[model samples]
Target: MDSLFLVLPLLLSASFPHFTSAHNTAPPPCHFQAIFNFGDSNSDTGGLSAAFGQAAPPNGETFFHRPVGRYCDGRLVVDFIAKSLGLPYLSAFLDALGSNFSHGANFATAGSTIRPQNTTLHQSGFSPISLNVQWYEFNDFQRRSKIIRERGGVFRDLLPKEDAFSRGLYTFDIGQNDLTSGYFLNMTPGEVKAYIPDVISQFIAVIKDLYNHGARSFWIHNTGPAGCLPYVLTKVPVTAGQIDKYGCASPFNEVARHFNVKLKSAVAKLRRSLPKAALTYVDIYSIKLNLFQNATRHGFEHPLRACCGHGGKYNWNKDHGCGSTVTVKGRQVVVGKSCKDPSKAVVWDGVHFTEAANKFIFDRIVNGDYSDPPVPLRFACYRH
Candidate 1:
């Protein structure tokens, strides 16, 4: 943990060599009243957990001090975004218990994809709540919240104001699953590449739908380096030659890069069509890929290993995943346990990043170092 503080400065300096006091010195030019996030496990607060079951122990042990429906040991990148904007953590749209949608609601569920899979969660380990489904949830929430607020009383405080839809920031961190799902089904990288256009088209449709519903600011994150994730490394078959020096599967990363390129181009086209909207295409792939390639430099270790998994070369096993239990010699024991120090680890589970790592990525992107048009998160409402 001490190493984090020491190397964090270096990490920040390396991200933006022109880093100055002026960056943090400036105040936010505009205010985003709320944030409506849509994605998968990377930014999911509680949607999947609420519908299925809670993510087991050690999941939210870092910052929240208990399991709070986040995949990370503490908070996701979205949580940091809320804190930075002085807003409260977003409630999941599907979670009815102890929720406050006054600021905004998260429609992201773990294992979600841009294109809906035909298989069930038990069959494919993917969520039924696709990007389009999330858009529908948001559409419903937007309409019903206004109706309920008209009655006033306690309900008014629990839901967002009508104007919040237009003033809120719409964020997306999906598409990684769309690529991996194909791989899991034994499809070639070429096959996955073939469907990317359709996936991206669906994504654009949702953004346009949101725009029609009055969302003016969009903070869209292109998917991260799927090849660098332990989940992919363990699940997918790969030739040693396909693996890069960084211990990532080169072919998979190439596909991910291809997806990002298409997504960026789509976002650029969306900007011209939706003239009123401020669309920021954040290059999360580069940021995460760089972190994996230079893990030790950022005070992290085992870039390709899961901090909370049972056993394997990457400490990941599909059958006995993170939080899995087993009876060893007639005694029940938790096989998948967290590392001693999550701060020193980049990945938490095989699929998700630790809170420490999320914070690291968030800090860099908040300065617009990885975003298009070079606009900070504070001024994302402005179209460059």
Candidate 2:
């Protein structure tokens, strides 16, 4: 009778298997453990003005009540990226006011650039931290994190050799400012086109450097259709009555196409060179195209029009830009006006996007809809 009981217990154990293996077999949560963001105003979350206290209006008023240095009504692309990854909103590392480096931090500064000439946005003589400087900051973060771990006596276990390779995702969304600033500086579209290849080469080098620093996964965004931006359309002299079917300027779209071709090729070559790296190209160009093509579907009434502006001819206010305010009836009133629902508008300002627009882009990234192969590299890697 004792031998029979022992045999029965052994049979049940064999049938059930170990609890640890069962847990391991179950799919882990689909969340990005960490996020590292580097870019411009499109993703800057209070990095610039927070450091200098330079005031801007209508920015961050949508969600955060007061301005948060994100040159938009609400969240920027970086915020959406973190949200999609299930991580908290990435704070700006330099934002002494609201700086937090727990989950991740933003190293992007407004008016920064990929190339030296790209810093033309700060036409006022004083230059902000360029992309090169931002990279230096990233290096500093790594050093500081290592120091903290070592001093806390957890370095040996917390930062294992494999941790270097297991470092989190890195995202970069820049170059639009470079092109826009060039246009503002009186550089013709042809001249800007001639200079973009060198700019792309510099970008490639930056990515490679990050890879050398143990960054295995990368998300790079192609330049969006810049000519469609309100800033460009208002500034650059497009030919009268020459608009594409989507109401965008033809010459500008042509420039964007040219840049995308070179960038796509460069990314492909980089992938070949760095076989172990998972470099995924986010198709901002295509995503923007989709948004423009299906503007009504996205609920945008006027994709080409700036939401916060007042002017008769150009659909933008000449004297007052977005965030400018005026005194009205003994109370301060914001100069620009927003749509009843920002989600129904695409252009947040003369150059950026609305929070809803960012949400759409995030959806594309998370759902693996932005890549040419129609699957995000993160998911594809896990599946394999």
Candidate 3:
């Protein structure tokens, strides 16, 4: 079955993409101190649950050993980036209990979108923390930080104040939902295609807003190969010819490629416009695909199937997904199941990658091969 994970690289293939791997990374580039991350599930550390209080087990099972609201089984790409920069793990902006956001704050959330609502594109709605809302939150954080500084309180732990924001790395890892949500929202292909311009415009607006707010270094990630995701493949219609040699849907991958192309073009235009900013466009798809191309090299035995979820070819049953529940008799019961070795699987659930896979990705990202303009995090991006 095309959707089966129950049934699912080598030589660093040049035909795919080029990424240089250096064991020793460079000093954090440009003396950037802190990192403020903004995105969806891919980079969210704990914002989703903090905002909604809707976390479940098997989420952080492989790493944190508890549900920390992360969609993955462990730390995300931003987590790895933090570690590579010798900085503390970014604390979610909404996690107030025992976290200190001195290093920086994460403003990402699961199911987030760049646009609040693109009705012309038939977007159903927007996550509470859309890109616009996140920007507003950043402004609010700045306001609060300033107030604390004046009050003679130790407020630096809350967020970056004034000059601190200038040297920080503002990372944007969003837009996957914009490209994939329309499929679930029942939007037409032409509607989806037409929506791209608005998406790019809204994205650019934030980059400029951050620049206006004293942000200098920018780390932007292009969307991943959504067509190859277990969640998309299980629900979307896929013909035999649509399935590639690697078991991914060819048409969907093509759509994702098109999105990347446009995203790259948008970044290029931004580069021309924001000449003072040291911006880096990350090719998230190719590095992730490299894991699939050389699965064994990265200790991955299954790249398409998930390590957790209910019964299905990909181990993903929409009705009883990783965090879903089922009513048994008169009581609600958790029906989601998980594999023994999540570290060996490429995916943790149907939509996100496993911690091991994220680590592999961070290795390549820090090495500076998948980024546009190729500023290796080793020497180009430093922490506070």
Candidate 4:
């Protein structure tokens, strides 16, 4: 099901938080010249769409007014992060046409995971552009972009400065797909949990690789509550006992929690190994779960149901999802479309969050309230 090709826009902005150094002096905010992002749909600007095809219609209607690579109806969390830092939106590293990499590049593709999948995109709907592949692409871009810039002309203006690599902020929001993929393959939760250590080890290796490549600042997000997503609840079979009071699947959420714990531990280990690097482990799972737990208080309706899509308890159908075109009577008609307003709902499609929800989550996390070390995003360069 294409609906399974999910993306979560992990972004941070709003409400600047204050942080002081060991000397009791405030650490000045970091001047991040650029951002080098890697992950899945949560932070992907257009990697998968540019690789396969555009995300079709009504996908970007809320903000861009047309499909512009993002799976959400409007901006993603990464978009807010760029704007908050006074940088332009990151151009997808895979987007070759009319793309300018002056500010930064996003390597996240929809349905991507930490470990490489053994199935074709058409067969399993999982992106072949795994985390390691994205790292390779980043490594190559870092080298080639400089060489091209040296040639001067249009290339120089399009590519980022050489120093941008070291001064840039590296963000990550992946791992959910790894768990989901296991479930899709009929693996039990315990079975999926078994490989988490290996999944985390691979993730840690990539971070170390980036560190070796001069990446000094990182903002890594643990996967969110996958059980709360409409796609998982509707697509995956779960018993009543598995459902939590918040209407989320407890088994899936528990697995996600386990992943977050391991990821946090890995980040702590990275801090010890890559002592020079500034790593911020953001607790996005708690932030998102709170939103669902207090949907009305957060001004959201149907936190578990998708704003777009057709026919089902959650308004999600794997076959006829948001923007799905169906041939009614020799003529194809778009039955899956946007609702009256997407802002009021939390989930946009069956997987992604609406722009409003993205902003809501962004506003809270940017202040460092949900981040380890409680450091604001602007000052994420500091290890403290």
Which one is best on TM-score?
A: 4
**RMSD (Å) of each candidate, 1 decimal:** 5.1, 9.4, 7.6, 6.5
Candidate 4 minimal-lDDT segment of 10 residues: 4-13
lDDT of 1 by residue, 1-384 (tens): 344445544544443345425443332355888999999999999999999999998889989888888998998999999999999999999998999999999999999999999999999999999999999999999999999999999899999999999999999999999999999999999999999999999999999999999999999999999999999998899999999998999989999999999999999999899989989999999889989999999999988999999898999999888888999999989999999899999999999999989988998898777889666687788765
Backbone clash pairs for candidate 2 read 57-323, 310-317
lDDT of 3 by residue, 304-381 (tens): 888888887888876678867888898988777678888799988888888999988887777556777655664343
Native-referenced Cα lDDT, model 4: 0.89
Clashing residue pairs in all predictions, respectively, total 0, 2, 13, 3
Q: Worst lDDT window (10 residues) for model 3? A: 7-16
Please give the CA lDDT of all the candidate structures: 0.90, 0.70, 0.76, 0.89
Models ranked on lDDT? 1, 4, 3, 2
| Model 4: residue 365 alpha-carbon error in angstroms | 0.9
| Candidate closest to the true structure, highest lDDT | 1
TM-score of structure candidate 1: 0.93
Q: Give the per-residue lDDT digits (tens) of candidate 4, residues 4-42.
A: 112111111121223443444454679999999999988
Per-residue lDDT tens digits of candidate 2, residues 1-384? 244334533332342234115433423333455677788777888777766665376666677767777878888777877776667787787874545465666888776678765233335322367677778888887777766666555443332232432457788888776676666778778987998898789888888888788777777778888777777788777776657877788777777788888888998898779866766777888888779779898777788888766654435654667767778899988767665777777888767888888877776665445763344434322221
RMSD of 4: 6.5
Error of 3 at 52 (Å): 1.2
Off by over 4 Å in 3: 1-28, 118-126, 188-190, 327-333, 381-384
**Cand. 2 TM to true fold:** 0.82
